[model samples]
Target: MTTILHIDSSARPGRSGEQAHGSHTRRLTARFIERYRQFDSRTEVIYRDVGAVPPSPVTGGWVHAAFTPPAAREPWMVEALAQSDALVDEVLAADIIVAGVPMYNFGPPAQFKAWLDNIVRVGRTFGFDRSRAGEPYWPLLADAGKQLVILSSRGDYGYGPGQRLEGINHVEGSVRSVFRYLGVTHAYDAAVEYDEFGDERLLRSLADAESATDRIAQVIASVRTRRHAA
Candidate 1:
């Protein structure tokens, strides 16, 4: 069975507009998974909701425990270290990852940032080899053979060849670049622009999400087929 890691990172549960936007992404991803499952009953989907509540930032103790050898760790260090290890394992076990990341202000929410910090560890997702000079840091998550699909919602960010709000689209680039650094070569983004929060705009956004769901399903099927063929 192929495993997929599904993640959602919008802060609002049912209160804010951003939450509403993320809900659309969540539904779309679910639909995509359902479509994928129809063809492959053996596929397993694992979920993580960082938006349920704010996630804690990695602390000094977490850093120490994460970097230290497990055999020499104290009891208090065990829990934090274990959490990080489990998160890493989840990422490693997945053949595909679908994540919903809403734009907050100009970037992702703090919970998403916290989630990223937990999974992106030195010597795990990346490494620094002293033997190398200019290229001291190297990627270590290369063997996972995973693909990432990102769904994002933004406000007032128009898309075009020469859009004035080009800077606001940095979130997409950031997600792609960081995941690439972790050796995720196949990363794709699907975004719905909810710049206007009117009822008409909302409906349009939902329709776009429906289309995106179908698109994702096709992508998933194609990738799984290629994997099996290989």
Candidate 2:
């Protein structure tokens, strides 16, 4: 069975129109999940709400403990890395990952940053190889054969290619960079823009995003079906 890791980083709940508190990205992700389930009932989903219960930031203690060999680490060191280990395990076990992230202040929220810090361990997601001449850093999670789908919500428009705010849009860029470092090259993005200007523009953007997300779900389902048959 295909295992999907669904992560929501919006500080809201429920689908759109259910409550005014719900974020656009959360509603998009919900629609994606609903359509995905309809395509494949046997798929397994593991959900994590980082915005509601953010992971602890990586501190000095965490850095030291993560670098230390597991066999030589003290009890406290082991405890410090427990969450990181678990998060890494979840990623390693998943075939697909769906993430909901909202653009806040031109970037992702601190809650999403904390979750990224926990999962990107030195010896876990990536590694350093001094054996090379100059470029020694290599990704351990590379070739893990996984796909990532990102759902982003932005208050303003013109964040796409050749747009007015393209250069300043950090939400999609940051997410792609981190996942690329972890060896995930096949990543897709679906975004809802003009949220602050809630009207016909917002409705049109949401519709476009929803269509993109549905297409992605269909593609993933087809891929999983082929993999299962093989």
Candidate 3:
């Protein structure tokens, strides 16, 4: 059975009027997961919440431990390596990955970025080799065989012509590039836009979110069916 990893990176709790972007993304993710699980309960699902309170960025100790051979690692290094290894292992095990991310200051939040940095490692998720020169790059994540779907929340970014927040494209582009760099070539992203607008616009955004969730469910089901057929 294929493994799916679901991640929520929203810091807010339910029913808050302040309404963070990640909140809507999280709701959409939950609905998608419920539908996915109903279709295949036997498939493994791994759920993680980085927005609830994510881990800190990797430190010097972590860097040293990650480079060191496991047998030679000191106790302190072992502890640091354990935290990063567990997260990286989850990514390695997953066949499909789903992430709920909200744009903060034109990019992903610190919490979510921290998780990304932890999982992406040199000689782990990817590597560089001088042998091929122009294309000397190699991927350590190739064996994981994973695809990705990202649910993004943005305020006032239409992803179309002449939007003031057009720069928001960085969010999607960055995610796509990073995932592809890690050997996930088949990745897709869906977005829920305009949360900062007042009541009417917020309601519209929610409606868009609901529609996106439905579409995501359909896509997931179709992909699973195709995989099963193969």
lDDT of each: 0.75, 0.89, 0.76
Candidate 2 vs candidate 3: the lDDT winner is 2
Clash pairs, model 1 backbone: 156-195
Q: What would the per-residue lDDT of candidate 2 be over residues 1-230, giving only the tens digit for each residue?
A: 77889889988776676787578888888888899989998778888889889989999999999988778999999999998898888888898989999998999989999999998987788886679788788788788779999999998999998999999999988999999998998888999998888989999999999999999999988987887789
Stretches of candidate 2 exceeding 4 Å from the true structure: 131-134
lDDT, residue 149, model 1: 83
Task: Tell me the tens digit of each residue's lDDT in model 1 across 1-230.
Answer: 88989888866454233465335556656666777787778899888888885447899999988777667889988887676777788888898888778777767778878888888887788886779979988777777778888877766546422777776666777777888888888876766666466567766876776687677767777778888899
Residues 121-230, candidate 3: write the lDDT tens digits: 76678786668668777777766657788888777757633666675567767777888888888776777776777578777777777677777666766777787799
* Candidate 2: RMSD to truth: 1.4
Off by over 4 Å in 3: 15-22, 129-136, 160-164
Best-to-worst order by lDDT is: 2, 3, 1
Better of 1 and 2 by lDDT: 2
Q: Would you estimate the TM-scores of all the predictions?
A: 0.86, 0.95, 0.85
RMSD after CA superposition, every candidate: 3.0, 1.4, 2.9
Give the range where candidate 2 is weakest over 10 consecutive residues by summed lDDT. Answer: 12-21
